[model samples]
Target: MPFASQPVRRVAAAEGIRASGHWPHTIPAVRQLLTDGLDLDPGVTFLVGENGAGKSTLVEAIAIAFGMSPEGGSTGARLTTRESESPLSRDLTLTRGAGSARWGFFLRAETMHGYYTYLEQNPGMRPDPQFHELSHGEGFLELLRSRFDSPGLYCLDEPESALSFSSSLALVGVLNELTAGGAQVLCATHSPVVCSLPGAAILEVGEWGIRRTTWEDLELVQNWKAYLQTPERYLRHVL
Candidate 1:
């Protein structure tokens, strides 16, 4: 695809930064990202990994680097509650596509509540979704329906947290619509259903860092398959 079509084309560490033994730097995925830049596809790109594998970290850094609020919202949002974000955004560099839409939004599952409250406090010209009055999953879908209309970079961190199986399917449909409209999406997710969006590039993050893989080949998919086929087979070990 043309460089002008996507929002962020690449992500790498800023020049003159050396990898260290810091918390995030020590993570293999972060180290690899700093050493070798990651190229994003024009449409949707899903980062899938086990918990603590740095997928969320990468998504958060990319969103912040692209000028979205750390707590979640559009580039213009100033939502801030706890300052627990890492310093990786400061060291990371995002290569913006020429003539692409500069606007973007970050839907961070953990902080959407705060972002909704922020929106209420700073009401804009647009009508509020009244997120506080809706259920968690309803609020998420409402936010997406309201804000995901524009063509820009949409970064989501574990957005399926509040969604059910059918709701996950709805999210996938929304994502398809977004990409079809020239939007770019970077999502960090553990849900097999959500990441199953057709044509989405899946990157597996693990001890080996990052590697492109197919949906059928994803560990997440295989594990879910096995667990569903015979839950006793896997649950025996944990139980």
Candidate 2:
């Protein structure tokens, strides 16, 4: 498939703007994206890193630039409980594919409760899922199963936060379904189980910036393997 056929082919800083000694631009991955554009794959792309590494920042900017709400939801959604989103979206530019679907969704884990309430307040033609009644993990899975059936750009920020091991696997399955239907997925995650999606592009985000890597070679996976092999070895430091 042609690169332009995907929802978003590339991401870079807007013309005439330079990465400064600012909040988000100080993030190495964001700086790299601004200096040298990052090309997105046609299918699933996973961003993995530690906390405060700007994975969520990049994902949020991409989603906002693609017209999704800062909180979470579809393109038309306007849910906002607070004004805490970074100012990176305004300075970022998304190079969308030539004939890709403009329809997209942003699944922000932190503000999903607000998004659910927003859905209830503004009922659509279709019946909204009872997101409140379900448990946290169940709600995430249900939302993925129901809302993620469409073909478009789906940016998920730390979706595994509310998911268990089995649910994480199920999330990967839903991602597979989306990719099969020509939809694209950009996810920032920490779960080794979640990022282990076969053939999914894995980008390590950190002080070194974003670098394309493999599942076996990922620091997250290696650390998980080490910790699992001997929990005491890792627990000793923080126990």
TM-score on alpha carbons, each prediction: 0.98, 0.97
Q: Which pairs clash (backbone N, Cα, C closer than 3 Å) in model 2?
A: none
Worst 10 residues of 2 by lDDT: 1-10
Off by over 4 Å in 2: 1-3
lDDT of each: 0.93, 0.93
- Residue range 1-239, candidate 1, lDDT tens digits: 34455999889999888778997998889999999989999999999999999999999999999999999999999888789998999989988898999999999999988888899899999788789999999999999889999999999999999999999999999999999999999999999999999899999999999999999999999999999999999889999
Worst 10 residues of 1 by lDDT: 1-10
Cα lDDT tens digits for candidate 2, 1-239: 35568999989899998999999899999999999989999999999999999999999999999999999999999888889999999998888898899999999899999988898899989897898998988888888877998889999999999998888999988999899999999999999998888999999999999999999999999998998899999788897
What candidate 1 gets wrong by more than 4 Å, as runs, is 1-4
